[model samples]
Target: QQQVKQSPQSLIVQKGGISIINCAYENTAFDYFPWYQQFPGKGPALLIAIRPDVSEKKEGRFTISFNKSAKQFSLHIMDSQPGDSATYFCAAITSGGSYIPTFGRGTSLIVHP
Candidate 1:
């Protein structure tokens, strides 16, 4: 079984600061990297993702930077706000494999106004 390790069990950031969460995976077969965000009483939602082909990807205030050689990826939230406060999880999935995602433990983000 592949293992995904995420850093920083929790995080606190200012309303306009940048929040970064990192994750590392053991499987080289993993092809997709997606970051999921979940708020209270809600299922995880895809925030952003990046493939090994791309080094970086950006969507709105969220960005995913991937390092294939390092087998790691990170999520960068720019201009983070209190509304963005949620538990973030990193996941990896392989289309040819089971297609089941291996997720990180999750990081709770608290943005202070």
Candidate 2:
């Protein structure tokens, strides 16, 4: 089974600082890396993603850095704000396999003003 594990179950950041989170996986068959952000009472939204064929992918303030050999990945948030505070989850799944993903426990980010 594909398993992704996340750390620091929670985090706190200043309104203008950067927030970083890490994740590790154990399945070599997994080929997709996606990060999701979720607000209270809402569903998670795809923040960014990277494939094993690529080293990294960035979308605005959100970036996903992938490591194929190490079987690890990380998410970086720049210029974080109160509005950016929410739960972040890292997930993995095979590209052509079932779309359902194996997710990390979750990290609650709280940006204080």
Candidate 3:
């Protein structure tokens, strides 16, 4: 079975509001968790990431919270803007192994002005 699952397949947020996406993984082997953001007609880019050792990581308006015991993680976008609208994916990879990442289904976010 796939190790990762994501929820709220799609989301809509008013401008200046916050957007949240959640993901959970079943494999204990996964040590690296990353979130990717993609715009139309472009490849996905790394947004934020957290290691099993860290409880949370934040940069700019993006934040990632990780729960090692629960094997779950979440992404929060603060002050979302229309330009921030994009498809987001949460992925897990095993450290010191084949670095191939298992990606979640993806969350489509729309920020309306």
Candidate 4:
């Protein structure tokens, strides 16, 4: 039950619009959730994250809304720009010793100008 399922394998949005991606996990043991953004030919970098203790977290134009009871989370990008076009991944990891994250299949977002 360590799997994380992401939806809308691909998304397209106009500039100044909002882009949203959703993810769900089956493992309640996962206590740490992080999102990553990656551009072509570059490694993924940490974008934003949220723990079960918090219902939501926001950083700049990016926001993560989490539902501990539903075991689900989503990322919302406001005023999406072309520069925001990239592959996003949602991951979860267990607490305590192991820090290895279980990643979703990833969602590719493209913002049109």
lDDT (0 to 1) per candidate: 0.94, 0.91, 0.95, 0.95
Question: Of the pair 1 and 2, which is ahead by lDDT?
Answer: 1
Candidate 2 lands at a TM-score of: 0.94
lDDT of 2 by residue, 1-113 (tens): 53888977999999999999999999899999889999999999988888999988889988888988999999999999899999999999887888778999999999999
User: Could you give candidate 4's per-residue lDDT for residues 10-60 as a string of tens digits?
Assistant: 999999999999999998899999999999999999999999999999999
RMSD of 3: 0.7
How far is 61's C-alpha from truth in model 3 (Å)? 0.4
Candidate 3 residues lying further than 4 Å off, grouped into runs, are: none
Worst ten-residue run, lDDT, model 2? 1-10
How many clashes show up per model?
Answer: 0, 0, 0, 0
Cα lDDT, model 1, residue 9: 93
- Best-fitting candidate, measured by TM-score? 3
The root-mean-square deviation over C-alpha atoms between each candidate and the true structure, in angstroms, is: 1.1, 1.4, 0.7, 1.1
Single out the weakest 10-residue window by summed lDDT for candidate 4: 1-10
lDDT of 4 at 95: 74
Q: Write the per-residue lDDT of candidate 1 for residues 1-113, one digit (tens) a residue.
A: 53999988999999999999999999999999989999999999988888899999999999999999999999999999999999999999997889999999999999999
TM for candidate 4 is: 0.96
